[model samples]
Target: MDPKPSARVRSRTGRALLGAIALTALLAGCTATGTPSPSEVPHATTPSPTASDAPPASDELVAADADRPLEAIDAYALCRAQTYAFYPGDFALLEYAPFDEASVLLRGDGLWFVYIEVDDGNRPADLVESGASNCIVGGTIGEPKWELFGVVTRGEDVVDDYDAPLPSA
Candidate 1:
């Protein structure tokens, strides 16, 4: 059974019209430049606050804690400023070799001692002492604090020789 010429023409026209409509809908979702249309953009998700975002409840540093290395270094630098009167730019020349030595020491008592050994050669040592007392007592007391035990110089030996304090004891 052969369809009429008019029926065949209508069937072809209907299929073409449906295909054109589908193509138009798809093309409408993208710009001529090929970027996604505004309607096709994904919704933005806002992130919630995490534990890292929260501030510390207490600002104090515990002596027995393992994470106090940076804090200990900071305390040493601060102690140099207050007790020794060493300024930032000039302090390096004083030849404080504390960092060259171990900056932190763990004692048998389970407490940490933050100490810096200073070898101040003659002229630099004189320049440092002129600013203030060469004695440096560390900042905080609860934990291991730096005590000025020895200040060595050329042709002269000076020593305080005090035992280090333990946080547990």
Candidate 2:
């Protein structure tokens, strides 16, 4: 029998086969020209693009209804933005409590309190290990003269509290 192929040659052939299989899998839904096949092309449901397809203008976002007891989502966004202004670091909002009708009655129209809980994803490893991963932002809807921010050990139990706006960058 002819001498068997060298181990190096066999290994090369195996690697080539694996690469070809991976390439085939990656391009399976495409045509021979490497473009997506007709069936793979997504059909547009609308005849033309809509306004929402584009990013909302900053003015548009700022112009959202300012009434108290806003939709839960709107309140959440307001609180999240306020929180970001304070933190300015990578964090995710964990929860939010929007002022309610009773709150409006006690405070006033357009005067709503939002408590936003956030997870500080960019905290140092030491802080993370020490369970300092969460914080809270408490403020009114339209930039109150003052706001409360702090890291908490237990639910709503603010530990190191701060009452001033973060220095502008």
Query: What's the TM-score of every candidate structure?
Result: 0.31, 0.29
In Å, residue 116's CA in model 2 sits off its true spot by: 3.4
lDDT string, candidate 2, 1-169, tens digits? 6599865678678879999999887678678897887778768798785777866654445556332334444444544554464444655533233334111111232333344444444566544322222222223344433323333433333322222234455
Off by over 4 Å in 2: 1-69, 88-113, 129-169
Count of residue pairs whose backbone atoms collide, per candidate: 0, 0
For candidate 2, the TM-score is 0.29
What's the lDDT for all of these models? 0.46, 0.44
**Candidate 1 has what TM-score?**
0.31
Counting only residues 3 or more apart in sequence or on different chains, how many pairs clash (N, Cα, C under 3 Å) in candidate 1? 0
Q: Give the per-residue Cα lDDT of candidate 2 at 43.
A: 88
Candidate 2 worst ten-residue window by lDDT: 101-110
Q: How close to the true structure is residue 64 of candidate 1, measured as C-alpha lDDT?
A: 41
**Candidate 1: misplaced stretches above 4 Å?**
1-42, 46-75, 86-89, 98-100, 106-115, 118-169
- The pairs that clash in candidate 1 are none
